[model samples]
Target chain A: MNKGVAVTGIGVISAIGNNTGENYRSLISGKHGISSPEILETIHKNLPVGEIKISNESLAEDLKLPKNHSFTRAALLGAFAVKEAVTQSSLKIDNETGFISGTSVGGMDTTETYFKDFTQGKTENSRYVRAQHPGFTTEKIAEHFGITGFVSTISTACSSGANAIMLGARMIKAGKLKRVIVGGTDCLTKFTLNGFNSLMILSDEQCKPFDENRNGLNLGEGAAYLVLEAEEELKGKPVLGIISGYGNANDAFHQTASSENGEGAFLAMQKALKIAGISSESIDYINTHGTATRNNDSAETEALKRIFSKNLPDVSSTKSFTGHTLAAAGALEAVYSLLSLQNEQVFPNLNFSYPMKTSGFMPVTKLKEKPINYVLSNSFGFGGNCTSLIFSKNGG
Target chain B: MEVKIYINGIGSISAQSGDLFSGDSARIYQENIFQAISPNYREFIKPMALRRMSKATKMGITSAKIALKEAETEVPDAIITGTGEGCKKDTEKFLENLLDQNEKLLTPTSFIQSTHNTIGGQIALNLSCKNYNVTYTQNSVSLETALLDAQMQFDEDPEIYSILVGGVDEISEKITSFRKLDGQLKSKSIKNLDLLKEDSTGTITSEGAHFFALSKEKKQNTYAEFQTLFIKNTIQPENINEEIEAFLKQNNLDSEVIDVVILGNNGDNRYDHYYKNLQQNLLKNTMQLTYKHLVGDFDTASGYAIYLAANILKSGKIPSVLKLNDIDSKTPKNILIYNQYLGRDHSLILLSAV
Candidate 1:
């Protein structure tokens, strides 16, 4: 039990791809998924967004849901990804299996559709009302998958997915559950589109993580999940990677902005490294939390430099390909980190034309192959919530 | 050695006064949805910072501060919050304004406060306590999940001394009314205090915020030990007995050892049986208590149950107003809080005298 947390299976559906295969191909071949909003209906048609191409109706049909089912788009995406993880890992989901989901806007798509109707005495659409809460979507996903065990939803803004994974690993280590399905789901909605736009952090063009000319982030929609099994229960199962370390720390600096020195980010990485019982030099790759925003990139860069001062590993952000998926970003990149280990390849950071002056650290902009043993991924969210997860090559 | 978790301080802003059950009868509720009794707020928060906060943020911050102040601790190692429908008012406001203004010229205040983690983020900013921060939004079991997380923290990191954990849910005009249509709310307006007597299909609704400063180092004011907690996404109404037995067995206790059982029965005809099955069967002879009739039902209303247990354990006396069947216990020793929503998100919490 003291060895490590084993990630037996991983599943992800992002703007770059519908499944892990497509996402991996798109990643290595330098295919970018950022484009104009096709699935999301917004006034800013010219604004680039990393939106999944499939519609809710198509997603529901893919899941074989009923016509009048109450599953929201986010639930559909989560169920879709979780199905892949469960199937890939050959995992048995019984009464002891736990489902932990991370979502910021749970079912707001349904709420926005039925809110006005509810106010006008249209009571039939009331089922969508409570679904707006982040927990409802997790419940819907769990119900869809028949995961009738302990279920919890973490909604710590952007770091939610990483936190969900952290909690699931903790629960497994505590002998609370034998296996757990953990990840996050979020769909691009007009509410978030307008909200991030209101904050003036919505970039009109493709996001450039760690680039000097980075302006802001392009909101995206996606979901990813991983099957974490107790070390004893694995029983010779094919371990994709090991969740060796996880750390969480809040910036406590501002509501939506990071501090000048990225205190929370620094502490999060430090704690994660300490938990893994490994030194900074042991990390082969670092998947950074580069949102491409003016505040986030510079702050993250500064934090990265502080943690890996003497010898920096190959660092990169895949946000350029998938955009910032908000709550799903952490889990999405976790999949990428594991993919890098499984394939022994490095995915380049797209659209980074120039390096920032603060850190002066340019991300690997070209696909390359190398032997990697450990990878560290960070996800920092609004409300100053920052989480770092260390995924190491199995049997490392 | 087993690390122990204790409830050192508690702050609550619910339908009744925060300092409830102070040698007096509990306040009765007549409305369908009970609003929390709010404090001055200015006394705890600065004016400039207070102006921008929504009702949920205000309640969360003020109650967190009260708990910290009472515990005599300045900063906690971590801050965790459980919110069912977080900042619903702000969310509705942002949606309405976005629709009205055609998604243009919208401000970020309502949008910022609308997120589920705003309260946790704001509390961190106010206290400048930068440590592990997370929020759970899982309907009825939200607060229980927070407690479970804190328990796990103590077990995983013995160095972690204290964590600020709480649950907050605010009622809004459109959202509350919308829930009525889902058959979750009572069809007709009835006196909430007489909720159990009602032959209705749904229950009353309400708003509240409750925070607690939990620590491994038991202070002089420690009310009770947070012995154990668990959350089941669901269980059949008929199968609850076995689940309770198993949970109790896990904690090395049974119904007889539980001196007081706090039941979250909001009088929903279909689901009240979940509580009555215990009130009249396994835990029937044990002292039974109910609180939703007074505070009305909300997602995180179980937080009040924890408050009730802590206060009862500290005072060594049960408030007669919360009595259900009059089975008496001279001094309440061990308390169990069981809560669920519409037959889903079942949670069990065990609190014992420290």
Candidate 2:
């Protein structure tokens, strides 16, 4: 372990890519994954989303599951990403390897499909009843990997994945576990699509993060994981990067909306900087929470100006590519942050044309190669849960 | 790096109401489902806030306040919570409206309250404690995860003083009824007091909230000190005793040193054998206690056992109503709490009198 909590390996499966390499390629090429609804059966066909082309059947077949498998689409996506993470890390999942996952809609895909059927006397798929719980998907993943220790799931809306990573680092720093595989996964369902639609936050067009004319965010689904090993457990292993600091704070202003000044966002960034033992001037890049919603972009920009002052780092919101993946957005961006560290390059924020009038800030519109040292990624969610994770280059 | 963790205060709301240690009344349960005998939520929550919260959020906030007041702490440094089917009423409302309206014209209230961390977030907002807030939702082990995180908090940070850790779940119409179809509930109504006598396939389903004010510094009214906590995702029911013995050995305590052994027994004929093996063998001579008969079985029902254990430690007295065996002990110094759900998420927690 070079420094901080060592991040040994990472894996991701999203609309833009199915693995880390694919995601990196797409990120460098500025390939936005936004498209019109193709798989989801909804009334609004014009709504754009970052939908993965693969079907649940293909995902199940990839895992060689039986026909009567109770694994939900979320669990399948989680398993797919976890498998790649395990392979990349070559880490052994034993009694000591804890697993922590973040998920919003754990298995709603299965529950919504069979809720009426089971309640109306159909009992063939009754095993899916427990899928209503978010922990169900985590249980599926833990069982798949044969992990038996300290398994937990966090659901703090969109900031869930970042909080999961935060807890993992805290666990390691506390000397509770020697190693852990932490991440998050969530699959799109009618429940969330309609939930966001009802909130009137779902955009009908491709999301343009940090753009002045951005109307709303496009919902997406995916999963990602990172292997974090403690100092004692790291014996000359290939470390991707080090998680230097993480902070979580609540806005306490609204149930679902961010404050105009982004108080929670500002506090979270300050706490992270203090924990990392660094100053704000050291952050080479910032992966903002920008969900393409007007409120989020405006508030986050104000928070950025407050934290970084006039000299803001090269900031971009990756949601322009992945369309806010809810719980998985944090970890997905964490992987992107690590990719930035390893390649010494900054990925551009796609689809951003105009700058917001209030903040008068522009996200990096083109990919830039630079000497990256540390990157800060932000994930804000409903209930005013704001979390920021800072990743430092291993040798830096 | 492990440090001593003490249960400075405790609060619970279930079929048995008020302070868990206080002798409230002759508790009786006639229905299979045990709706919590609630306190006046208005006393703990503001009028504007209480209107939007669901049953789970209301119970969680109220119980958390009771615990904090008992500990005489105004605001905890951190708030950690565990919930399985979080905000069930709001989830049901949102889902029902979504399906009924074909996903149109639905308000964001229910959707906003539908997340698993609503209770934890609401508690933090109510207290305005921005230290560290997290929520765990791993089925039955939800509360255990929270307590473990609390222990981690105290262990990692030298300055963190106190934390509010809780486990809560709520029951709604559609979700509870659907659970019946999944073979998670008893086929017929069984008297709550006679839960152990029946050879039933499933146990009764219910909900409640339990919160604890845990601190590194023990006060005169400290309930108990946490010794160790462990979890196993899956262990064979037949080999549960081995797990318990191993956990005890690792903690450097023998089985005989345990004055009270709290077991989670809900009379599920399919899974009660795990408890029977422990009660009849290793812990036969110790005072055995059961509480699901009074609290009903929920995801975080084991939290009630911790509340009971802490009271026994603080008062040096065990209520006769909770006694499963007649083992006599003047003071219970060490208590072991073991719980599992459907033979998964098995956990063992050891506590000692401060």
List of chain A TM-scores, every candidate: 0.98, 0.98
Model 1 earns a TM-score of: 0.99
How would you encode candidate 1's per-residue C-alpha lDDT over A239-349 as one tens digit per residue?
999999999999999889999999999999998998899989998888989889999988887888799886899988999899888889899999999999999888898
The predictions' CA RMSDs to the true structure, in order, are 1.2, 1.7
The residue-by-residue lDDT of candidate 1 on B81-108, one tens digit each, is 9999888999999999988788889999
lDDT of 2 at A117: 87
Measured against the true two-chain complex, the DockQ scores of the candidates, in the order shown, are 0.85, 0.70
Q: Which stretches of candidate 2 lie over 4 Å from their true place?
A: B18-26
Report lDDT per candidate.
Answer: 0.90, 0.87
Instruction: Give each model a TM-score.
Output: 0.99, 0.97
Give the lowest summed-lDDT range of ten residues in model 2 chain B. B18-27
